[model samples]
Target: MTNKPKPVIGITSGDLNGIGIELIIKAFSDQRLLDFCTPVIFASNKVVNFYRKTVTESSFSFYHTREFDKINPKQVTIFNCWDEEVNITPGVLNETGGRYAVASLQAAIEAFKEKKIDGLVTAPLHKSNVQSESFSYTGHTPFLKDSFGAPDVVMMLCADNMRVALVTEHISVSAIAQHITAEAILSKLNIINSSLQKDFGISKPRIAVLGLNPHAGDEGLVGNEEQTIIAPAIKQAKNNGILAFGPYSADAFFARGQYEKFDAVLAMYHDQGLIPFKSLAVGEGVNFTAGLELVRTSPDHGVAFDIAGKDRADAGSFIQSIFFCADVINQRSEYADQRSNPMRKIAPDVVSRLADEKIEE
Candidate 1:
């Protein structure tokens, strides 16, 4: 049998004024990454060269193409999205940056629809800068959900062994309590459990649920979200054959390193989970969107405008995101194959007969 072809990965060039392009160039500078997947960057040659000059000694090279059919698998492919003359001011926020960022994303989304790419690894884009009437959303998760028609998606942060999935993302803290319902929590738990099994190859994922309130509402004295909202969700998850346990105090849980005991942790809101994840991830974390047919991962850190053009951005997380995307693509394919033709156990008598037949042969 022959080996499978390398997966085609689509990468979006985020915020021209930020460090998105720099990170992409730095990550792909190492030719060794090409052995795993064929990378197709959705940006014009001009935009890439603007930052390529700033990376000190970047050896990144690419094949420029206007048609998807002409993508070269041997080297990186720069799928030119546009050919307009625009000023690129690094470390500055402007409409030009936002407009072109959207263009790149739309181009990548089109490629995804055509099935030209197996997975996506997006560079960070500023939430405020990318906001326009036509593309108004908090961040990539919701935008992607609408683009792909996925009912809902979970924002999961991954670093080594620790995985944290958020039930609520990019919402105001004042409104967080209102959204933490039993149904919502249960939905996130289901997605995390399924992603762990299918994407991460966990046969039975053990999920730890974090509470919305401090000290887990102190058993209902500080708040009742744990008892009323979170507890019911955990109970229902267990009933549904998911081994989910929690309503654990967010402080004590991380303070004691309890996240290592489970496959994934479900946090009630954004900062509640991300703060701890970023602190512990030590620049090795990446953001993965679960509960979608398409696989998407991004660098855990955002567009660092302060350090933009300084060549100070670390590409570790960006590189890891690519690795994560490829791993998930391969895992999902293997999962589909196994489910399509599962192995059957032979009975004792059948095994004996098969053994005797083999011996006679």
Candidate 2:
């Protein structure tokens, strides 16, 4: 039904010991998925074979590509990120896992820079182990932000039922207040609104902005952030032609089920949005990096070291992540074309003339 060219999705295998490879293997086992998009995994052949022999139940075909021109569209292919000798441990956390994780990601990023790949889907990596001189940020979002020199970015957690973005992520709770300035809030809103329009193909997005304190700050009794910073930013965003709303109290907002009415929700901090999001849609949620020039997504869950080799880690989120990336790529392509030649608005007289012409025909 779709005539669009298949996007080559670049997947970065996360911590070698984690369930990242297992998730990738399980998701790609079905050949029919190839009809949707081409997958080019950035990993070593030995590491993949180890996973196939150890964890997976069925065979997954992969072509080892010496060059991007050799990548096959019908079959999954390994991009040959590194040729270094390595050992595969299922459940242990070590420095080696981080090293390859970085290697795979850097190779994919280079390809993305060169326009060899359409988008990226990253597997889970442990926060502590994935550190390097090149990647010192907390997680995937900041690293991508800095790598591309993006001024700022939004970490949006999206599922079938809900879409929530954070104003702040991976920052200390005590320091959250200091960062909740009007500028930060407004910038995030701009990102969320723009992403909802271009990335997700939403025409007019209605966003809900949640409060930082309890009980909507009880009219400044609980916290002054709602009055001093959050509200002013919402006003500024609305003035800028964004359909943004709220300073909504998180408790009543979710408990009363008010989120169902909006296109997206913006939270003040990490736990404020993620706690409820995970509870409602953990296995289905996809972590999307909004406001970046390049498209990237990941499974909402982290490196589950406990279930590394147990074959218990669910591939649902990762599968969704791939499909989401594909959809975004298609939408972004259309968005670019539309932006270049935007639709001309029809006036009342033009509409009447068109109706008259149709009647005459």
Pick the TM-score winner.
Answer: 1
lDDT of 1 by residue, 212-315 (tens): 88899998899998988899889999999999998899989998999999999999999999999999999999899999888999999888999999999999
- Candidate 1 minimal-lDDT segment of 10 residues: 340-349
Question: What C-alpha lDDT, on a 0 to 100 scale, does residue 212 get in candidate 2?
Answer: 94
* Candidate 2 per-residue lDDT over residues 15-128, each given as its tens digit: 998999989889998787799899999998888888887654765879987699998898999998888778878889999888888888889899999999999999998889
| TM-score for each of the candidates | 0.94, 0.94
Please provide the root mean square deviation of candidate 1 (C-alpha atoms, Å): 3.9
Please identify model 2 stretches exceeding 4 Å from their true place. 343-361
TM-score of 1: 0.94
